[model samples]
Target: MKGVIRTILLIALICIFSIQFTMSMVIFTDLDNHWGKEHVNWAANTMELIDGFNDGTFRPDDIMTRIDFILALNTLLVKKNIYQDVGLHFGKGINISYTDVDRYHWAYGELAILATYISEYGNADIEIKEIFTEDTFNPNKPINRHEVLLLSRAVTTPPIEDHIISFKDVDANIPNYNLIIESVNNGILRGYSDGTLRLDKNITRAEAATVLRRVATDVNYLADKFLVYEDIKSRNIGIELPIFQQIDEHESQSQLHQRFIDAITSIQYSAFVGHIPYHERHLYDMQPIETLWGLKNQNYYNVIGNNYYLIKYDKDLVMERKKELVKEGLQHLKLNVNSSFDGLISFLSIAAELLPMEETMNAAEATFRQSDNSKTKLETGLFIMSQYMANNEMDKGLNIHRSLLEYEFADDIKAQIIRNYGYLLYSLKGADEAIRILKDLKDEMDLDFNELNPNAIEFTFNGLMKQILIQSKN
Candidate 1:
C-alpha cells in the first residue's frame, strides 16, 4: 500500500509540472494565413518584440504605429548592447523634443533616443525635427511599407543593387524602388500573394517582427556603421570631442525663418534631385489615373516622388491636374490657415518645389502674414522662399530674407536665417558683402568654431562663407 501511494504522488507531481509548462507557453490560434508564421513565433517567443492579444491571437494583420515600431527597435538595440556602454543619459541631453510625443507616451524615451542615435548614422545629417511637422513626432501614425524599407536602408548597407521587384505594383521609378529591391534581396521585406508590394500599405505587426528579425540576423546587416556613435561614447578611446553644440542664447526671428527654409529645401532636394538608375524609364510609364489618385490621397509622396515623377514625364499634364487640387486647397486655406493647415502646407510645398506656380507662392505668403502661429509662419515663409528660388527670382528671395530678419526667433533658427541672408548676398551683391555679413553675424551668434565641422549645419554656412572669402581674394 505504501509503495502504491508513493507512485501516485510522483505521478501527480509530474502532471502538475506539465500543466504549468503548458500554461506558460504561447500558442497562437490565428496564424493560418500568416506568411511569416515561423519568424513571428521565433521573434515573439525568443525576442519578445512581438506580442499576442489576451485571446492568444497574434492579430498579425493589425497595423503597427510609429511608437510601437520604435519600441521594437529599442528592444533590438538593447539586445545588441548598443546603449549598454553609452551613458544612461545618452539621448536625454539632446535638445530634442517632439510636440506630439509627450512624457506620458509609452515609448517616449526609446523614440527620443533612437531618433537622436539614428541621425548620427545617416549619410545626411538629418536632425529629428526635420522629419516632422514643426517638431511633432506624430507617434501614433501607422508605419507604412515604404518607411520600413527606407529606414532599414538608411541604417544598414544593402547586399547589392537589385532593380528587380517581384511585386506587380512596384514601378522602378519610385523613390523607394531600389530600397524595396534591396530589402527583398536581404530577405527583410516581402510582397502579398496578390503580387503586390503594396508600397503604401500600413505595416502589420507580423511584418514588423519579420523585418526586425531580418535586421538582426541577415548577412547584409552592417555593425560597423555604428562605430562613429560608439567611438563618441568611449571617452577614453582617443581625444574626446563634442559631436554638436547649440548656438547663442538669443536669435532673431529672421534667422529662424531661414533655418526653416533650409530644412524644407533639403527635404525637397533630397527627394526630387537624388539619382536612382532606371528611374527615368519607369517615370514615363506612370499612368494619369495613378497620378490623380496619388494627388488625391497624398500617398506617401516621399516614397515615390510621384507628383514630381509625373511632372517630369509630362509637365503640362501634371500642372493641369495640380491646378485643380491647388485651387481647392487654396480655397480651404482662405477659409482658415489654422483649420486647413495640413492641406495648405502640403499644397504649398508641392506647388513651390515641383510646380513653382506663381499663384501658389502668393497664397502661401498671404497665408503666412495672416497666421498667428510662429510655426505656420515659418513653414509658409519657407514655401514662399523655395518657390522664389525655384523661379530664379533671387532679388525677391532676398526681399523675403530681409523682411524675416526683423522678427525675433529661437537661436537655432536665427543662425540659419543669417546663413541664408549671407548666401543671398553672395548670390546678388558679391562675395565681399556676403563675407562681411557672415563674419558679423558669426560674431553676433557667438558660434563655436571648435564644435563645428563639415557634418554640422553651421558647417554649410561657414563653408559658404569660406568660399566667398576665397573668391573675394581671387
Candidate 2:
C-alpha cells in the first residue's frame, strides 16, 4: 500500500513537467511562427492568465483591449500569490467604484479588484492616470505598448541593472521613454527588426502575453521548474514511511490532525542523509507543506484511513541510481571518462543555469576551464549557453553552440549536443526544426521514448524527446 501511494505521486509530477517541456505551448493555429509564441504559451498554460475565444482561435494578433489587460493582470497577481484578499472583498469591503465598470458587467469584480489593489499597494510611480479619466475608465480602448508597461511597473520587481535597450526610435524627449526602455530592459518588450520602438502601436495579445509573463515570474520560480524532476525515475525522491495510527475515540479531529502534522514535520525533506558519497549528488522534488491536510494532498498519503505513512526518500538509492544512469549515458556515448566527474559536472552545470544569482557558477566554470578536456569544455559551454539564453543574448549563445557541435567526441556527446541544440530550436527556432532534428536521432538510434509508466515521464533521453514530437491539440 505504501509503495502504491509513492508510485502515484511520482508519476503525476513527471507528466506535468515532461509534457510542458516536449509539447507546443499553444493550440492557436495562428501562433505557429509568431515571434511571441513562447510567451503566449507560458502565460496561457503556466499562469492561466489568458484563454482563447469560444471559436478556439487565440486571435493572438488582435490588439489587446483595456478590459482584457485588466483581467489578465488581475489573474497574474492572484496566481502569483503576491496579493491577499483581492476579490470582491478586500477585508475592508468593496472600497472603490468605477464609473464605466458597473456591478452588471461580467468583469466588474475583476476590474474592481485590480483597481483597488493598485491604489492600495501601488507606489507613487504607478498612478492610474492612464486608465481613469474624468471618473470614467475607457475599458474598450486599445491598450498601447507603453501603457501596459506603466501598469505592470506597479506590480513587478525592477529589471536587473546594465540591461541593454536598443530602441533607436525611442528618443529621450518622449513622455514615457523611461517606461518603454524599462520594458525592453526587463525582456518584456522588443522593438521591431527595423529598430523602431513603435511606441504608439496597439499592443497585440502575443505582445501583451510577453509583457505579462516577464512581470509575473521571477528567477527562483522559473529555476525551480528545472529541478522539479531530478529523481532517477521522475526526479521525485520522496517515499512513504508507513505510520499505522488507529483512530482515537476521545480525541478531537483538530488534535488528531496536529499529531499527524507533527509526525510529518519530523521527517525532513533534505538534500542527503550524510556526507557526499563518491561525490554523487541527489536533487529531490521538495514541496513545503504547513498543514497536515496540505501534506496529505501533496504527497497523496491517506490520513483518513487506518494506515498512514510519512514521506521521505532513501539517499543511498537516490544517488546510486543516478550514478547508474550516468554510466549508461557514458556507455552510449562510447566515451571513456570518469563517471563521477561527468555526472558531477552535469549537475553543476544545471545548477549554474537555474540558480544564476548564486556564486556556484564561477566555481563550476573554473573547474571546467582547468580540466582543458573535451567533456569539461562541452558541458561548460552548455552552462554558459543557458546563462546567455537567460540574459537574452540568444544570438551569441546560438553561435557558440553551433561551434560546439563541430567538436569531435563520442556519439553520446554528439547526441547530447544535438538534443540540446534542438531544445534551443524548440523555443527560439520553432517546433518543426526541433522535431526534425530529434526525429532523425530517434530513427537512427531506433530508440524507445517510453518511460517507467506509460503515463509518466523519465528524465532519460527518450522521455525528453517526446516534448518536441508532440504538438498541443488545444
List candidate 2 stretches off by more than 4 Å.
Answer: 1-26, 85-98, 102-106, 131-135, 162-177, 219-474
Q: How do the residues 34-55 of candidate 1 rate in per-residue lDDT, one tens digit apiece?
A: 7978777767877788678889
Instruction: For each candidate in the order shown, give its overall lDDT on alpha carbons.
Output: 0.57, 0.52
Best by TM-score: 2
Q: Which residue pairs show collisions in model 1?
A: 252-409, 253-407, 253-408, 253-409, 254-404, 255-413, 255-414, 255-417, 256-413, 256-414
For model 1, how many clashes?
A: 10
Q: Give per-residue CA lDDT, model 2, range 287-395, as digits (tens).
A: 3223443544543222221111211222233444444433332232223221112333344432333334345455444544444445545655666556666787766
Q: Provide the global lDDT of candidate 1 against the true structure.
A: 0.57
